[model samples]
Target: MARRGKKAKGRPISGWVILDKPKGMGSTDCVSKLKWLYFAQKCGHAGTLDPLATGLLPIAFGDATKTVPYVMDGRKTYRFTVRWGVQTTTDDTEGEAVGTSDLRPNADEIRDLLPNYTGEIEQVPPSFSAIKIGGERAYDLARSGEAPEIESRIVTVHSLGLVEMPDADSAVFEAECGKGTYVRAIARDLGRDLGCFGHITELRRTTVGAFTEEDMVPLDELIDVADENREELDEEAIESGAKARILDFGPLDEYIIAPEAALSELYEVMLNDDQAGRVLAGNSVLLRGRDAPAFCDEAFATGHGRLIALGAIDQGSFHPKRVFGGKG
Candidate 1:
């Protein structure tokens, strides 16, 4: 007889954790810490934020991981401050100064340049970015003393405006843009256009997809909540040292937003018991009723207010692309 494989540890919890990522921590590190805290079976992030940047980082656990692509495809809003006079290799303060300038543009001058950057435009990502070239990350190659040529691609900027000018050396701006848009590149290009040569001094992402700063939970707060619940464990378990072994997600579950929250943009179809069963089994269910959509390239099915599957609608039938667990 064949030997059975070991089962994965942790609870199979599923939800979204909108983290207020602290500065000096990488996105991957944030995910790891949250996973360990929640003791979740699976976890992922919708987008990458540099270690120096802070604010909203949408993390997905278990079934929510299936919707990461949708969250990443949503628009993002960022507020950043640019130091006008020096350009860096990374286009952020984390990099070394590659060039300098003495010129500074006033408020009106900066506002005048905003329109040119709005709408679709070509942008070359920073050399120290995560973009891959020849199967290696651009940043990795740059750190190895190799100058990797990064190609320019078109990205959409929904709106760009000057928020304020704190001083002659720095200007604050807010931008709402589509997926793949680089805020660092915006600051770099703005400086170059103004002949001031700039780099991002501070960056904060306020929104990503349906997640906003309001949804963010600080790490300290989560830690405090978990620590406070330790007293609830039984004395017997504590004496046996099984208290540490027990992974009760009840305390932390309140902070986790429902997984369907990430899929708000997709068309949702309410399914009956039979329909949901078929969807859960990786099959198609005919969309009926007056409100039924004729066709949708991407949509989700929910049964009894719980997510059943992420799929597509064609010819009046919803085909399950990814089936999810749970009664919903």
Candidate 2:
């Protein structure tokens, strides 16, 4: 008889891991690296950060992956530096410089320009972006010297402030924006608006939804702990030990958030044993309590603080749209 293959490794770990990503690491790579270090069965990130950018990258594991959409749709905050008088093909320092000017905007000029960018505004994404044109990414088109016809879309910039006039040729800014907003585009447009070519010199994401820099762990720190435990008997042993070191920080139970924490902004309805059973079965049931509504679309059904199902209320009923890993 032929020998059977070995069983798959890694734990069915569930929850969020906020990583303070460093520059030069792509978001997809960061997710993959963290997935291996944690030995999680599943992994995903809230948003994609450019390889040239750094900071808060919320990574979800196993059941927490179900809540990725909620975090992805939430507010985002960024800190970026705009280098005036020079523009590049990629609209960032890494790209070849395509244009330059001697004119630089003064502090007062930048401050005056901030109001124009705040609130709702029309923005054309940078050509060198992940946005799709036909079946291909726009950046891929730009890379081939093909101009991707990108249209303007309304994106909300909740707030924009001039953080500092760091030098005669650059200005630092902090922006609170909604999903789909591009800081690179902002720098490019700001340069044009200021009568000088502009490009991003540095960029960092400070927050995404309820997660922030305060909740992030540097990848190197986590990797070092795992490296020290390499002599452990198995993958689980090393993963457990690495988590133990990280858990001392208290932001996570074991390098993972409580699964329910992913949907913290949504209203929660704790179900009774019978109701929990119904939800786990992928069935709808009436919710008990004064806050229960006819249509609580943005709600989560929980049992003893554990996520049972995420769904909506219709006709005064709780429905299980997306059940957790335990089939609930």
Best by TM-score: 1
Using alpha carbons, what is the TM-score of model 1?
0.93
Per-residue lDDT tens digits of candidate 1, residues 80-187?
999999999899988899899889999999999899999999999888889999999999999999999999999999999999899899999999999888899999
Give candidate 1 regions above 4 Å deviation: 231-248, 326-328
- TM per candidate comes to 0.93, 0.89
Give per-candidate clash totals. Answer: 0, 2
Pick out the ten consecutive residues of candidate 2 with the lowest summed lDDT. Answer: 244-253
The local distance difference test score of model 1 is 0.90
Question: What is candidate 2's lDDT per residue for 259-300, written digit by digit as tens?
Answer: 777688988878988888888889999876676677876789
Regions of model 2 farther than 4 Å from truth = 1-9, 232-253
| Candidate 2 positional error at 162, Å | 0.4
Q: lDDT of each structure?
A: 0.90, 0.85
Residue pair clashes in candidate 2: 308-328, 324-328
